[model samples]
Target: MGWLLMIALAALVLLALWKVAGFGRLGLQLAGAALLLAMAGYAWQGRPALAGRPVPPPARLELPESAFAQTREAMLGAVDQASFWLRMADSYHQRGDTYSAAAILRSGIRAHPRDPDLWVGLGNALVVHADGMMTPAAELAFNRAAAIAPEHPGPKFFYGLALAQGGRFDEAERVWLALLARAPADAEWRPMVVERVQMIEQLRAMQRARPTR
Candidate 1:
């Protein structure tokens, strides 16, 4: 908005110059027209959204794509368990088939509705499926996980990443910072959580400095 105002002021100066100057009238008119066009562009860029919204960036996950299946299976166990199903879903997710990952989680939920971890996994898959947009279903999935297991870090961690992906960096940072406070001193995932929180803080600072578009 400030940039647009600055451009508008510059255009007014050109218009004023055109009125005062005997020669170079044509040049002044052309320059004023160009400045007006630039102001319009600046105003458009400052708008929060356009008629057709752009696709958001994809969400980031702590587990690298390669670690999805093998790591989870080795650490969490077999197919009948919800964690195993989460691993299977993650395997699909790693291949860019978020729909398949979501489907897997839905099936896992049918068998293990009480499992908060499965709910969190579904939320993560849904966020990815939506290209990092926080759809109502994804929000519900995360909320369900939090309700089922208030103390669990899985939902908050993944949901924070989703929030960050959607350009809600402040909210993401708040969620992560709170989660970090609750993390155990010797928790294996603590370092990763701390790292993510710090990253979000840096991202928030960058966002503040960035011009809106």
Candidate 2:
């Protein structure tokens, strides 16, 4: 019976704790008392006679590639040494391992200190790792990237993205507006920026119309 198996398992655990784990007499007594309390609680509440059902496996978490990856490759060269590191980080990011992605970017930054693309990637990884919140460290990484390449669009675009994701929509709009002002008419990524700005405006309008309790 389930109750018999439960008691046997508890006894085995207590024996291991007392012998292999070197618990003293008082510790063993306390552990035994805790086990008895747990068993008593189970006896009162548990459905021991119910048929056992198979537990379903957990669903897999599928992470997609960054939306800005293509734009980044367009702005920053795809064949450079920095790109190798970025690709490595991207692999980790796609696997839902943002911490490892950020760490890999850090190592890349150490090797290529002035690589703006690597810094941008690091900022993104940090933001994702923080559950879409724009942490101070992520902001610093974006700023460093911008400073390294004053004319590059990657840092500003991704920085605005992080800000928008963190619910700082107003700040994101301002940053994107500035980028648009300086962006060339024929720039490939300019259309994407314009679209994002329009989306932000719509979001703000919806927020204003929302009824507050």
Candidate 3:
């Protein structure tokens, strides 16, 4: 579309310049056409990533049965009822209503303060919130969750993401790289770590470009 527009506009400019028979006017007209062509070229080059993604059949995510045990033990026997809050929390999450999800998570945490799962859920909500303060909340949540389930990878990943988002790049790299080492060989998150590594490299490039004192 942009290419067509650029061509039509260039043709119109050339035609007008031809009718006027002024070399000076033609040069200016050609310059304007050149600018339009450059813009068209840029937009044409950028259109693919903007296209919507094709639907994918849900891939079966295989974690250990220990995953359920970890999550359940974190609930301290209240796992069954926790679903009530989770159902509502998920609705809020789906709508991008993180505040409500965070509130529900907080309510669940308060009701079961020792429940590691609820604490982590609340922390996850805060991390994902549009207005969330990542530094303090993610720090607290991941710390608590990790303290409770030191062997689990989920909280550690969240912690790394939180650190990255908060500009703690070195720490985030350490956490994520360690996770990549221990993660299941074919786990989806290993690819995610690759993406995060790319992000960190971009940030490092920008940092190197800055005037450092």
TM-score of each: 0.58, 0.67, 0.48
> Residues 30-60, candidate 1, lDDT per residue (tens digit)?
8777777877887777665548778998864
For model 2 the local lDDT of residue 77 reads 50
RMSD (Cα, Å) of model 3? 17.3
lDDT of 3 by residue, 111-157 (tens): 87766666666666676663434647656977898788776666776
Q: How do the residues 46-102 of candidate 2 rate in per-residue lDDT, one tens digit apiece?
A: 986799999997654558887656557765557487888888888888887788889
Ranking by TM-score: 2, 1, 3
User: Cα lDDT of all candidates, in order?
Assistant: 0.75, 0.87, 0.67
Candidate 2, residue 112: Cα displacement in angstroms equals 0.5
Q: Which pairs of residues collide in model 1?
A: none
What's the distance in Å from true for residue 59, model 1? 23
Error of 2 at 184 (Å): 2.2
Runs in model 1 with CA error above 4 Å? 1-80, 206-213
How far residue 167's Cα lies from its native spot in candidate 1, in Å, is 2.2
- Please list the residue runs of candidate 3 whose C-alpha ends up more than 4 Å from where it truly belongs after superposition: 1-87, 93-98, 110-115, 128-132, 135-137, 184-188, 206-213
Residue-level lDDT for 141 in candidate 1? 92
